[model samples]
Target chain A: MPRRDPAAFAEFVAARSPALHRAAYLMVGERQLAQDLLQESLTKTYVAWPRLRDHGKAEAYTRKVITTTAITWYRRRSWNAERPTESLPDTVAGGHDDAVTQREWLWTALQELPPRQRAAIVLRFYEDLTEAQTAEAMDCAVGTVKSQVSAGLAKLRDRLGDRFGEHADDLLPPTLMVVTP
Target chain B: MTELLKDTMDQAADSLLAPDLDVQAMVREGDRRVGRRRTAVVGAGVAAAVVAAIAVPSLLPQDQQRATEPVGFAAVFEAHQPSWATGSEVHVGGRSFDAGHQVFAYVQTTEGVVFSDPSGQVWASNGTQTVGVGRTDAEHPRLEADGSRVAWTTYGDGRPTEFTVYDQATGEVDGLAAQTGDAEVLALDGTDVYARDGREIVRWSLATGTRTSLGRPTGIEIEDVKAGVIAHQLPHADDGATSPYFGRELGETLAPDFYQTLALSPDGTTALGESEADVPALADTATGAVTPITVPGYGFFVGFGWVDDDTYVGLGVNEPYQTTPLDLLECEVGGTCTVTAEAIGSAASGVVLPFGQSMDD
Candidate 1:
């Protein structure tokens, strides 16, 4: 029943687009997909705009949409054919460097994390949101966030191994600590 | 250490994201999408043709032929708990983990469930023994299986660049130049594959190695094509959420909307809903009308799909309102849903069904 006020929706898009895009990119590990995710979320938000009494709630709702939609897209896309595009990260200039390789390794490793876990990591560490906030954004119980985060970090640790180097332990939250030592 | 990881991630995001979004452009795009969604609802049938395709399979005689008591219809669903997905026992790409390492998509065939693991490797499971088919390097591996044939696309970077078909019965693999001129593949149906090449639907027959254009009905992207009956889904995902009709061919066709369940009876005369609210129903493919068939024990089953024209197959939730282990079940058209508890392991749970054909396995 809600419809977005054009002016209000535009204003929100202009103001929050960058941050939302960054969060989306972090979750999906790709720029184009992040753009799609943001666009769809904003469009959906626009549709539900009139229904929301408090405009301030839009950010939280949009964040949840991004996380949930990213997971849905990831799941739906698994069986569909990929459109050939030059979206894969271009060959890095310092391809020979170990740090660059490690960074690339970490990037690939992050991509491997299931959507919810990647979402938890991005919200908790990247966006500096708390575990509770991540849970709220993910529309899941706090315990689920904790488990997903733990699972994600464990997968990352397993895949990256020594290539991830020291400080890897810090990647996990203090509660669900997973350290090689 | 957390700060460093954050820094790297932030840097990656920064490097990838554009400096800023075009505000006016976004508003225009948003309006455009909404406008498109508003107009996307249109509704299906190629009945006489689909009889051979969807029917012949279900028409097969059952193992139980009764004299004193009537025999029932039920699909042997390979029931596994939700936790089974993250149980950390699956070996894919030579690594075993759970939760994140899980089956992303699956095709339930008579042989078993041919599924794609997180790493895009195809594996077939009949609840017990699972065998990994050829390792499909396709990243997303849009896996589609009909009978003994399974096909998926290999993606490089993120785009679907190529599609490959695997035949389980023969252990033979054939790669389709499946991507059309636009370099996009849509649907793969056995040797007769379908793909969206830009604006055109490219029908490439892998069996004959012939490629042609099917100027299909506009506004409909054919989702399922069996026995010449093509199932269409709107190109836009938003429009798909509410529309009950999958796509129209000769008449209005019914689609699965609740609990992610859909069953097209073998004869194409009956359509069943997974939700208990709408159980046994007959679909008028010509008028898009639905007539619910009441049964003696209607509310006791979770619809998996139709195993025959006269009956629908599913799991029996004997205990009301509980997460109970399901039994193989049958909801006879204009009859009751009979539960066979002896088929203990047969229940559809914990599966990512793309096209919503759960009873096939």
Candidate 2:
């Protein structure tokens, strides 16, 4: 049969799917594509359930799949759009043009980044991975990760600096803070 | 060095970070599908022993074939695609080549680098394809031809990226902890492997965790622009932006030329690229000499292989006027080559990943 007790698996899905979808959405910038990627990775993980021996490692495997999927998706020319959707929701509306538009402005700015750079930013500041972990995820070097993060952040700064409040530089710290209590 | 830029990036990342929902559904679907497939296979076995023996081969067509002969090693390109039979599994996304004693690997993602293993197990750096860390989050970990050393990255969560080196013999991880630094282990030779951190790329002696700087790279350029994935080159922008205006205007675009298919020679001197120009091109990695092989009326080269440093084999479209299957070509260093066509059957669409312990291997 399947895993005798699948509640844990079900719970795992319920808890992680939203976050996974968000990450996927950012990476590919497509709701449907993100959903598809999430489904594909999750399905693979489920098939490997019998062999995944360690429950803790499941997330790692899934994440690897997600990143790999994003890379693969990025390779497809159809996935690359000149600009992601710029229309913002009314919820976050009505502030100074620059201040309120900061997030939307930055999102558009991010679309301009290279796929890997976009992935790095999404993984680094967004996902909160360490440089080493980000490197491993991207399948490159720590230096490459650093460069990507730096290059990506620099571009964002140049593109969105005007809108961000002062102290914006503190936003993309070169080194990630350790997750401490 | 700027804080406003950093904060804006931080905020942007935070804004985009959200839990994934589709992945969860697929996981559930995959589990159910695998169980169903297992039952089908079991049932097929019983029927095979009886009346369907003669009809089996005829019923199954072989349009695509899976290569099973294990050379020194193998790597996956695009990841596994899910299907009714096996759900999602392992995928071969890009290119693999050998560098002297080890094999070098690269991919189609924005994060690109050459990973090499000298002996069947041990890995080290032998070329200039340094790892691109902090640029992407795609990880497909494996050892070189020799199994002496193990290299893999820490993917997923926003931890610093790492290409780690572990002495298979000793089990100790070399260079950079997951949280503090970027870890990249490439071109491993014995205990000495080349590692790259966010600050720079260096050769680290695993035996001591000591490092030697390769100096700042000059020709190295980091473009935060995504090249069209599978389409030919995007329209050139005379406007001077690194990526064409098309990418900036549209969120994503596919350029067929971005579908890079790389094949390396055993010694790793000559590299062959299909899916590049309309004509096949042989590039000497060491000298950076690119020579294109011309084919009349054909679009770009699709797929190819390096039989040896001097000879190559590839699959390409021969006739421009006809709707046909891709054909095979045999090529040599001097641009002499012959072509042929093969009419093959088709196969089911499914992805198969190695089971647990097998993946560890």
Task: Write the residue-wise lDDT of candidate 2 on A12-72 in tens digits.
Answer: 6777776666677777766666767887777766665543444445675566568866786
Instruction: Considering only chain B, report the TM-score of each candidate against the true chain B.
Output: 0.52, 0.36
User: Which stretches of model 1 miss by more than 4 angstroms?
Assistant: A1-181, B1-104, B125-130, B134-142, B157-160, B180-191, B216-223, B233-263, B266-270, B273-282, B293-302, B315-328, B341-361
DockQ winner among the candidates? Answer: 2
Q: Could you give the C-alpha RMSD of every candidate to the true structure, in order shown?
A: 22.5, 20.3
Question: Model 2 residue B197 lDDT?
Answer: 51
Task: Report fnat in order of the candidates.
Answer: 0.26, 0.35
DockQ of 2: 0.14
Best TM-score among the predictions, by candidate number: 1
**Model 2 residue B57 lDDT?**
15
Model 2 docking tier (incorrect/acceptable/medium/high)? incorrect
